[model samples]
Target: MNELFTRIVSGVIYAAAIILALWSGKLATNILFIIFGLICLFELQNLLNFKNYVSYFVFPIALIFFNYFNVNDEITFLFIIACLFVKLLLLRDLFSLKGRNAFRQKKHLITLMYIVPSMVFLTLIPKLYPDYNTYILLYVFILMWINDSFAFLIGKHFGKQKLFAKISPKKTVEGFLAGFTFTIIGGILISYFNQTLSFYNWVVVGILVSVFGNLGDLVQSKFKRKALVKDSGKIMPGHGGVFDRMDSIIFSSTFVFGFLFVINHVS
Candidate 1:
């Protein structure tokens, strides 16, 4: 009973904050996400048992550069490539059944490649889109939320086949399909009201969030399994921590941002 209440309260608060930030304007959006990124970093460091104080100094400096500077496509592409490489390493580590020492050894690399770049891309989404189009960033969050919510509901009731039993035993293929289906419905609705992005683009966004967002969740679960911990932190009553809550967005936002980049610049 208490757990159920906690979940409801936390969900309401989280949803409110996200919606408020999205509607408030660009500065609010940027500041909210930046704070979120920092908290996620702190949680990630703790989860991995990394204790480097230098990250405190380096994160802001790097964010300032990426946020303020006129970074070109070449540099952005390089960052993406680095992020992908780190992602591969993370996947390898997740499945290896190795000891925690591997993560400890590569702590700095993970911080630099995985944590930093994901946050950077998340922060960039609002800035990269035109002023009128910042809502597109909000749309990404909405889709992710919808995907998560439906996945949980459908999975809880009907899930049978484990999606990734080793990493996340609770997840099911049925839940994944339900999430994807609802995300498409949500995307179509958003397109109807906004029209900032074409219906096709919105459909693409739905696919990215449904697929990659779930991947993000599994990846975080893998990290927790490696650490042999249940939740990342106890910051929220029901939600584990900033890292736990933001994992999906952290993973999927980069891909969504990449799509936006291609649409706005390359194509």
Candidate 2:
């Protein structure tokens, strides 16, 4: 297929998927994230060249599920403890796998380092803080999309100066600024509705979302460079893997999530 055709198809499908997912409501959103989490783990495994299929699947699912169980008194601490023990013991398997398989096998834990805590924060944010979460989460995600999409266009048009040519040759400082500026608007606009956020908070979150979000993109690009792969997967047609799609959101979510919590507590 032609690159243009691929890109067009990819954009439509991804936009559709995201819309459908958001429309599906909270439970559906969580489920969708879980599915994406699995895909990311799998892709990372392949990219990193991990070998153990058991680690590839079990731990990602377990991390989320265990965290879920931890929510209730009903789910035994003993069970969670056992899972933790097994999860820790799996370290041997990581060393056992050589080369690419090491990453593939350990992909779950690697992502666990990122997603588990974020999900925990997400799961609790709405309940712990009110009126703030909807906008925060919305900005976290929308800004990420803005960053990814505009960065591409801006970079293409005026990306004379390379930002990280060694990692992602195409990314440029001009594109980064363009992407960051647009995405930051999400924080400000969402702030209008949030009631709790002042203009200052909006500015801070916006800066954070843009800065860390761009860093997140660069981080993923570096990974792709190491893997010697262009895109994470073919699912997005012109886009890449779920990893590619959600790269900025991964960092933005955590950064925004923590920022709000800390601010809310301080006040």
Best by TM-score: 1
TM-score of 1: 0.92
Q: Which numbered prediction scores highest in lDDT against the true structure? A: 1
Q: TM-scores, in order shown?
A: 0.92, 0.74
lDDT of 2 by residue, 105-166 (tens): 44555554544444434434443344223334554566566777788889998899998776
The 10-residue segment with the lowest total lDDT in model 1: 95-104
1-267, model 1: which lDDT tens digit per residue?
898899889978987887788788756766777787778888888888787677666666767788777878799978877887777676676667654444667888887677678877876777766663467777888899999999999999999989999889999999999999999999999999878788999999899989889988988997788789988888777998878998998887778878877887865
lDDT, candidates in the order shown = 0.82, 0.62
Distance (Å) between predicted and true CA of 252, model 1? 1.3
TM-score, candidate 2, is 0.74
